[model samples]
Target: MPTAEEIRRRIIEHGLSIRDRVIATMPQRYSLMVEQIRSIARSYRGDFDTFLTNLSSIKGLDLLVIYTALLAVLSKHKSLSDEEILKIGDSFDRHIYDVFSASKARRALEEAGVEKEIANDVISGVVKALNLINNKYNSPYLWIAEQRRIERFENSVREVLFRNEGGNRVGRGVKLFLRLFIHDTNIPLAVRIAYTQENKKYILHGDMYTALVTLRSGAFEDVASITAERVKARVAKRLLCEAKEGGARCKDVVMRLESIRGLVRYVGKISGDPIVYERGAYDIGYRYCRDLKCEACPINDVCKRYTFIKLK
Candidate 1:
């Protein structure tokens, strides 16, 4: 079996490989979204209010605030795909302000064909998210751009995640939004990626979490079989922390996280547009781990699962 350190190296190496491949060829929906945001940013010419006004026009950004609140309550265990999440957001975009109650939102999502668990989870998350954002910033769009200090931005994200009841200050959705928002306005990739990495908390969801757990489990027995999302996230964070502390020159952790999340925005190497990897990476990773298809997995050789196969 590969040593834990070796496993860590392998994961980081594979993650970097995934990052390059995906960044080179971004997904259509995500690429389009970046383009659209950039187009608006270009038109606005650095007017904050106008940029925000047009930005909130996106359901994902607006819906995100509500969900961030929900994430505080439910935690950041995303069970939906990016497509599904965006579709649901679009459905509610027409009248999200008009419907504030869980019952109302749940019923609407159900009518729109969302599953019961998903509907319940989404509604539960947003109600508190809306309250928190409203009491503080009054609008989600403002919340994204309100804090000038990175610490303040990180704090709000933590507040949203912990349901504003107070707990460890760590968050993801807002940061993800901030990433896209800043990148759209032409923030340097190094700056944004640095912030994301410095912030220390990775943007995670179900598939990404699962893939990490599987990789970790295959290589390290200590963390193997961890199913709790929060616990799994901590383990994932620790791996990167160890790598960083060891002075490993592994590629950007944030980009690797984005690669797993199935979309990334980087200053394009050959073009003016940001490179965006399409959604489905997490799905593919999840499936490989879920089905135990270790032999055919792209990173199988680095994974301990391959070690098992070798012994057999």
Candidate 2:
């Protein structure tokens, strides 16, 4: 097997290659999405109440926030496929299209095959968050606009996003939800700021966690050495700094690591952004590193298949 350092190098190379390729020739992947996001951001300057009353279109920003709240909660369950998640989202969307009803939201989620407790958790937590947004911040858009620091802003968003109707805490998906919410190109303006300033603080999602731990084994101080999410994220960021400083491909490596860390989004894909360009080379339709389709994986020769799972 290749050494861990070699494996890390290979991962970085493949990720950057795919990123560059997509940016160069796949305008269709992000161009339209970027433009649509720009239009949405430009068209809406009103506060949350007006946004709720005047905008009932599916494409409206309020709906996006609501949908993201729903999807982010559901996304915590790794077993659900993307199609299944979308189905659940659609069901909730239909029920609470113009107005949000907690009972209806829970029922729709349960009917769409979500577990009872999880459905309840999703609805209760999201409803509380939405209510807080309306009552305190006046609007989610305004909440975003008023923030100065990224960390404080993220914390504020997380506070509302984690709200539960019964005053109980929701599960550990709050940060994941925040990441997904801010990264969505539908709010390209926010993404531009967050990604540029704080991308280093992002934790690798579960999908890329295995690949990262595998590659880092025996090479350097392992991020798995810690269990705290903040500590682990700091370690991961430090590793990125070391890799960028020690390697010839500094900028490229950091960008690729960012891609793997769930900080970059291809038009339709999530998490597996580094390999979004893979197709004929792998002969597999779509492969995320977590899929462990090593036979078709471009980095298989160096990947160690090792895994550690204490990440948040």
**Which lDDT tens digits does candidate 1 get at residues 63-140?**
434533433333344444445444544554444544356776676567656768866765666666667777887776
lDDT of 2 by residue, 137-208 (tens): 676545553454556655675567754312112333554344442432324335433334443344333233
* Maximum-lDDT candidate: 2
Q: What TM-score would each prediction reach against the true structure?
A: 0.46, 0.54
lDDT of each: 0.43, 0.45
Q: Give the candidate number with the greatest TM-score.
A: 2
Cα-based RMSD of the predictions, in order?
Answer: 12.0, 11.4
Lowest lDDT sum, 10 consecutive residues, model 1, at: 263-272
